[model samples]
Structures are given as C-alpha cells and as structure tokens.
Target: MSTFTKPNHIGRKISRIRELRNMKQEALAQALGTNQQAVSILENSETIDEDKLIAIAKVLGVTVEAIKSFSEEGMINYFNTFNESDNNFNHYNTCTFNPLDKLVESFEENKKLYERLLKAEQDKIEYLEKLLKGK
Candidate 1:
C-alpha cells in the first residue's frame, strides 16, 4: 500500500532537475535561446508558456511530467524512491560567485587586517617594555 501522491506544484521539481544536471540558469537560458531572468522565473514556476516549458524540458533532459511533479508530497515520494547520496544535489549547486573563490579573494583583505592588529599589539608591548626599563 503506497501512500505517495502526485505533486501539485512544478517549480521545485523543475529547479531540482536543472540543478541535478549542473546547468546554470544562464547556461539553460542559452540552450533554450532565452534570458536567464526568464529561466529564473520559470524555475519559480511564475507563469511560463507551453513552448517555454517544452524547451526547458528538452534542455534539462527530463520529461514534462517530471517537471510537473513538484508538489511537497511528490517531492517526498521522489526522494524516497531515488537513492540520495550526499553529492546527489552537487550538479545543481552551481554558483555565480563561488564561496571558495570569494574566500580566496578576501584573503588579502584579512591578511592586511591581521597585520595591522599585530603591529598595534607589538607597539603597545614595546611601549610598556620601555616604561618598565625606565622605572
């Protein structure tokens, strides 16, 4: 006796599939010959035309039914049916600006701050040492 039901919402499912394929919104848009904003809107399931939906499905390598089955219950059932490893969502986790890249970028900024603080502390220690020597 299965208690699984179909999804009422489609946005989440579409988004998941897009992500699973590791396609960025911009890349998907390029494949569909559409804009990234439009792709974003479609992922959110705002209000896309039939042609757009068909194109999206084609680009995402999934059936229209898979995209349409995005309701909460449907998502739960889908996950239960599919074997979800930790890296299952890795494909869809593309970032416009990667966190590791950002961290590397800010490395110099952090280094400068640390150097300034270290110099200030050294100056304070030297000043205290001079006062003690005088006493």
Candidate 2:
C-alpha cells in the first residue's frame, strides 16, 4: 500500500488553527498581505518556507512549534475527553492554567494589537497632513 500520510503537515495545521480562531481565509490573507486564493494554495501545500510559516503563526496567534506539532485527531481527542457529567464537568476539566486567566491574557493581547493599529493609522494621518501642508 502506497499512500501519503503526514500528521504534522504545517499547511493543514495553519488552516485548522485559523478555523479554531474563528478567522476566515480572507482575514488571514489580509494579515499576510496576500489574497484568499494564495491562502487556499497555502492550505493545500505540503511544505512551506520557514519565514512564511513564522509569519502565518504570528497571524494565527500561535507559536511556530504549536503549528509544527498540531494534529487534528489530537484536538478532537482532547475535546472528546473533556465532556463529563454535568455535576462533575468543572471538576473533571480542571486545567493547569485557569480559563479566566487565559481570557484575560487574550484580552490584553487584543488591546495591544488595537493600540498598535491605532498608532499606525495615526502616523499615516500625520504623514498625509504634512504632505498637504507642503502642497
């Protein structure tokens, strides 16, 4: 039997991570300064350049290692194992890190990104204003 089997395929891993993050391919493409068709091709690729992979990981809000080691089956298994009786759900799903802590951390990261985007836009406006003054 000859068949291709690559559980750690980075392209597929990126696609899954994007989906889990509730991001569309167009959004990912925009973040990468590319297009939806390019993103589609990327997902179909078996191998990707390291620098590009790092860029994708950044846009996906994950580490390069996280994308490299990602597995669809593993994620399914993790969620499957998380279901428990209603009374014991919280007890059974006790995590090494608090969920609230993760939420707060995500909020902080989003705030930082928002601030950076605002600053960039403000800088662009200032530059345009200077140009107008010159003209």
Candidate 3:
C-alpha cells in the first residue's frame, strides 16, 4: 500500500511555516491576541477561514498563496537556494542581521514563555489548594 499525503492541510502548512521561521506557538499566539492553547488547536485544524488565514499569513510575513502552496520539498529546495552555491544569497543573509541579536531575541521569547508557564502552574496550584481547604 502507498501512503497518501494531505496536500490541502492549511493548518499543517501554517505550522511548518511558523517552525521554519523559528517561532514558538506562544509567540504566535501573543501576536494573534490569543493564547497558546488556541494556537495549538488552530494549528491542528484542517482549514481556516479566508480572512483569518490572510491575517495569519501577514503575521507570518508570507502571502496567503505562499502558505497555501507550502510543502516540505519546496522548503528544502528554498533553503538549498540559500547555500554558498548561490552567491546572491550571501548579500541578504550575511548583511541583514547580526547573529547575536537573533540569539538574544530567541532568549527573550523563551523567557516570556517560561514565565507564562510558571504563572499558570502557580494559578493551578492555588486553585487546587483552595478546593482542598473548602473540602
């Protein structure tokens, strides 16, 4: 038997694009004014409304058609074009941003995620303690 792929899985496409950009669900959720759990559910869905998809694409720095046509093979090929074999790729990738800035940005985002998670745990514990005291 041959395995089949679902070509029209919009949510999976969104997720892949997000991952390729080195973004976390919590970051994306904050950008979308939603929560991480909602983002998780959205990314697991098969489809999204056109308007929302457009908004998501905008936040992702891609066009809706780009997200719609995203594929693993295409992504590989796209990254391959950035290899040293392509002299043109050097100008943009080399001159645009500092590597340390990217590292710091990643660290900041991770810190925010960790803080949010810790606060959530604390809230849960407090609620459970209240219930126990009531009983």
Relative to the unseen true structure, what is the C-alpha lDDT of residue 42 in candidate 2, on a scale of 0 to 100?
99
lDDT of 3 by residue, 12-93 (tens): 9999999989999999999999999998999998999998898899899999999989889987887787684677756557
Expressed as tens digits, the lDDT of each residue in 9-56 for candidate 2 is: 677888889999999999999999999999999998888999999999
Give the CA lDDT, 0 to 100, for residue 29 in model 2: 96
The predicted structure with the larger lDDT, 1 or 3, is 3
The total number of steric clashes, by the backbone 3 Å criterion, in model 3 comes to 0
Point out the higher-scoring one by TM-score: 1 or 2: 2
- For residue 34, what is the lDDT in candidate 3? 94
Check candidate 1 and list the clashing pairs.
Answer: 19-92
State which candidate, 1 or 2, has the greater lDDT.
2
- Specify the highest-lDDT model's number: 3
Give Cα-based local distance difference scores for all models: 0.77, 0.90, 0.91
Model 3 worst lDDT window (10 residues) = 84-93
